[model samples]
Target: MLNVALFDKTAKEWREENKDLKGNMRDYASLNELLVLANMESFNAILIEKGLEQKERMIELRKLARNQMLSLEKLNKGNLKQLEDKKK
Candidate 1:
């Protein structure tokens, strides 16, 4: 479900699509993706404790994934630009 929210696919779906590949989709996830997955796991636990419905949790998780990914990407680009500027 978390995978569905973040990657828009389930572990089973990923495995079926990547039969030739080894390990699960997570094994092939980017650093940013893995970070978001961890955060989502924790957030999911909180949502579960709060008695939120699966649909509601999924909506919230997807929002978190999108926002966090964008923020991380921007931060990474900004840091890379800073490094390149320092080298110049």
Candidate 2:
């Protein structure tokens, strides 16, 4: 099972660690969210396709990447929530 609390803490730490990120990585939260969505879609794509051995290996790679993206997104969600809470 995935740990939401851990993700949140990780996000907060990421924010602190990259407070001054610029250019493409500036919108950390938004970027992470996009990554999460893309990862999920790709993961679904892998399972939806009934292909050969090489294709299966490629799909597995995609799933691995998706998992990583989701973890980052969870962290981003936690960080954003913490910021919102602080503003309250």
Q: Per-model C-alpha lDDT, please?
A: 0.98, 0.53
Encode model 1's per-residue lDDT on 9-62: one tens digit a residue: 999999999999999999999999999999999999999999999999999999
> Would you list the clashing residue pairs of candidate 2?
none
Score residue 63 of candidate 1 by CA lDDT.
97
- Alpha-carbon shift of residue 66 in model 2 (angstroms): 1.5
Off by over 4 Å in 2: 1-53
- RMSD (Cα, Å) for all candidates, in order, is 0.6, 13.0
